[model samples]
Target: MDANGGIEIERKFDVDELAVLPPLIDLPGVQAIAEPVVHDLEAVYFDTNDLVLSAARITLRRRTGGDDAGWHLKLPQNAGRRREIHAPLGRDRQGEADAVPESLAQLVRVYVRAAPLVPVARLTTIRVVHALIGAGGETLAVLCDDRVQAERLVHEPASAAWREWEFELVDAPEDLLDAGQAVLAVAGILVSGHASKLARALGDRLTAESPRNRQRPTPTGPAGNVLLASLGEQIGVIRAQDPRIRQHTLGSVHAMRVALRRLRSVLATYRSLVDPTVVQHLRTELGWLAAVLGGSRDEEVLQRRLAGLLDREDPAVLLGSIRDRLTTRSAADAATARHTLVVALDSHRYFRLLDALDALAASPPFTATAGQDARVVVPALVTKEWKKLRRAVRRATGTVPGPERDLALHEVRKRAKRLRYAAETAHPLNPKRAARVSGFAQKLQTILGDQHDSVIARERLLRRGGVDAYLRGENTFSYGRLHALEQQKAADAEALFWKAWSHRP
Candidate 1:
C-alpha cells in the first residue's frame, strides 16, 4: 500500500508505569486480534560521506526482518518533525549502496556533502503492534510496543546503546487519542517522555546535551554575525524544503521560495553589513535554485486556481481548447523544471556550495558594522527593505492600473512581506509598533499576491486556447470567467493598498 497525498498527524505521550494490562492484545469489548508478543528486528542505516546527515537532524536507514523493511530516509522537514520515505529492500541486503542514487541523494544534498554512502549504525527493535479501526472499517492508528538497542557502525565496535518505546499514529481522530491516553492512564501505562529516542541514542553525534540549542550565538561587536547566521539558517530551510516541493506537498514550494527571498532580502537590506562579493555569490546560487523550481510551483498555483475557476464558469462561454492547451503545456513545463531541480541538487557545485555555507554559518565573516544591538541593527534592515518597497511602488504607481501595475505591485508586496517579517522578529523592543507594521505590510502583500495570481491565470487561459486540444474539452468556459474575475480582483486590491499605505507608519 503506497500512501501519497494524505495528511499524517502524530502526537506523542509520556509513559511511566508499564505494569498495566498483562500485555493483552485485545480490548474488553473487542475480539483478540493477536496474542500479545514482541519480535526483534534489525536495521542498518546508510548515509553519504559519513554520518553527517545525522548532524542535520535526519536519518536514512535500510533495515531487515522488520514489518516494514526497506530503505528509509527520515528527513527533518521542521523542528521535531520528519517526513519518512520508504523504498523496498533490494533482492538481497547486498550491493545496495550505489552512489546514493541521484533521485534520493539529491533530496539530502544540503546535509550529505557528497559523502560516499555508508552504514553508520545498527538498531534492533523488539516490538508489538495494535491496529485500530473505525466503524467503516478504516484503519486508524498503530500502537507500537518496543524495546530498542543500538550498535554504532555495525562492522566496528559498539559506541552507542539505548532503549525506548516508539508510538506512531495512523488515520486516527484527535478525540480517540485522548480516550486511549485516558485508558492508559487508568491502567498505569504512560507514554515516553523523550521527544525522539534517536536523539537520546545518538547524543554524542547530535551534541544532544549541548546548551547551543537555546543559546543564540554570542553577539560580537555590531551584530553582523547575527545577520549572517540568520541568512545561513534560512538557506538551510530552503534546501530542506526541496524534497517536499518535488513531492508536490501543499505550500512547500512557496515556503522554500520565501526562504530564498528572505535570504536575498537580507543581503539587499543590509548591504553595508557584509561584503558585496559574498552576497553576490550566494544570490547567484539562490537564483539558480529558484529558477529551477519556479516552473513546477508556478504551474501548481495556476492549475489550482484554474481548476477552481472551471468549477464556477458558465459552460457556454468557455473558448476553443483553452483549458486543455494550458494544462498540457503546464505539465510539460513542470516536469522539465523538476528535472532541472533534481540535477542541480546532484551537481558537485551544489555540494561545494553547501560546504561553504556550513563553514560560513559556523563562523561568519563579520565586518565592523555588526557591533550595533537590535535597536540600531533592525532599523537599518527595515529601512533598506522599505526603500526597496518604495522604489517598486513608485515604478508601479505611474503604470496604468493593468497587468503591468499588478505585477510590479506584486513584487513590491513581496518586499513588504519580508520587511514585515524582519520587523516582527524585532518586536521585543516595541511590540505595538511592530504589530502595526506587520498588519499594514500584510494587507498590501495579500492584495498584490491576489492580483499577480490573477494576471498569471489570465495568461495561462490565453495560452490554453492557443495550444492543446485536451483543454478544449467541456471545461473551457471556466478559464475566461476566471481571467475576467481575477482582473477585477487585482484592481480592487490595488485600491486597497493605496488606501492603507496612505497613512504612513
Candidate 2:
C-alpha cells in the first residue's frame, strides 16, 4: 500500500471531569467552529517488551474505528510536533493483525533491532473534534476532546482512564495556539506533563527512574567518560537519522554517514582507553557502513556541483543535452544507491551492528588509561592528529600539481577530518582551546575537500565522454575549459593551504 505521512503539530492539555472547554471561536484568527464530529478510536500500540520505542518517545499503533485508521508510526519531532507515517492495515501472508507492516517496522528498526514487537498498550478513545475555521472558511486548527481508557497489556494487565484536550494546528499561525492556551487557562485546563498516551498508560514502568539516574556524579578523572559520551552522541545521531534515511530525506544519508565516521574516529583515537579487540571490530563495521553510504553522497555532491557550474556558464558555450544527461545519470545513480542503502539497512549484519552499539554504550570496555583525566589525555590525542595532518599537508604542497599531488591532498583531507573530530570530542572539557583547533582544522578540511571534489568531477566528466556535444554538432571545447578551470581551483586551494600552514598555531 502507498504510505501517507505528515508533521502533526499539536498541544495536549489535561482536563478535569467537571471542566468545560472555553470558546475556541473567540481565539485569535478563528472565526467559527464547525459542528463537532465524534470518533471512537481503538488503538493497540506495539513495542518491544523493554519499551525501547516508548523511551525514545516514538509510537507505533494499529488502530481501528477511526476515519483515518491503519498502522501509524509517530516519530517525535521538535516542539510538540510529530512526523507521522501511515500504512493501510492489512494481514500478512499468514493473516496476522497486520504484523506491524514492514513499512512502519523498518522505521523503528534502529531502536528495536532484532527484538520482537508485541502489543504494549490498548487504548480506546472517544474523541469529539471541533474544527476552528478562519474567515475564509479554511480550517485554522482542530480541537479534540478525548476521553481515554487505556489498558497495559504486557507484564501485568492494568488499566487507567483520563480526559484530555488536544489543540492541533492545521493552517493557523502559532500565535493562534498561544491564544487558545490563554483562553483554556481560564477554564483551568493545563498542558499535561506526560509526553504521550503510552507514557501515561504504562505508568511507572515507563517513567521509573533507572539506577543510572541515581549514580554518583560523573568521574572527573576518567577519559572513558569523555570518550563514551562522544560515542553516545554519535550513536544518537545515527539513530535519529535512520528513519530520515529510510524516507530518503535530503541530507539524511550524509548525516548518518558522518555519524558513522565520527564514531569510528573516536574509537580509533581513544583505542588506548578501550579494549583494542572491540574497538577494531567496531572500526571495521563502521568502515563498511561508510563505504555503503559514500556512493550516494559522492554522486549527490557531484550532481550539485555540476548543476551549479552549468548554471553559471554562458548560454553560447552550453552544449547539447548536457543538463539532461547529467540529470538522468544522477537520478539513476541515486535510485540505485538508495536501493543499496535500504538493503543494507534491512540486512542481519546491520541489525547486529546496532545491537553491538547499544551494548558498547551500556558497558564499554575501558582500559586502565580510561580512568585518567581527559584534560591530560585528550589534548595529547588531538596534538597527535594535528601532527599527522601537518605532515600530510606538507607532503602534498611540496609535490607538483598532478594526480600524485591530488592523492597526497586527499590524505591531508582525511587527517584534517580526524583532527577536527578529536577536537570536537575534547571541546566539552575546554571549549575555547578546542574551538580554536576545530576551527583551524575545519578550514583546512574545506579547502582540501574542494580540491578532492574537483579531482572527482574531472574523472566523472571524462567518463561521460566529453558531455556528448558531438550529438548537436558542437565542439566539446567547453568541457576541456571546465576541466582546466577545476584544475586551477585545486591549485589555488593548495597554495592557500600552504599559506595558512605557515601561520598555523
lDDT of 2 by residue, 1-505 (tens): 1249688888889998887878877888878899999999999999999898888889999999867889889988888789988999899999898489987888899888889889999999999999999999999999999999999998788999999998888898889889888888877878888888889999988843222212221326577878877877788889899988987888999999999999998888888988889999999999998889998898889889888878888978766566676678888997898889888988888988887887888788788898787778888888899888878877876887689888998998899889999998888778888898889888888988998999998886665636455555656666776777777877788788777767777
Cα lDDT of candidate 2 equals 0.84
Query: Residue 417 error for model 1, in Å?
Result: 3.7
Number of backbone collisions per candidate: 19, 0
lDDT (CA) per prediction: 0.63, 0.84
Best by TM-score: 2
Task: Kindly list the per-residue Cα lDDT of model 1 for residues 59-100, writing each as its tens digit.
Answer: 676666756666667765543446777666554356644334
Q: Name the candidate that leads on lDDT.
A: 2
What candidate 1 gets wrong by more than 4 Å, as runs, is 1-38, 76-84, 92-107, 123-150, 154-156, 159-233, 306-311, 398-411, 457-490
What ranges in model 2 sit over 4 Å off? 1-5, 23-26, 94-97, 182-186, 207-221, 308-331, 397-400, 464-481
Error of 1 at 402 (Å): 5.9
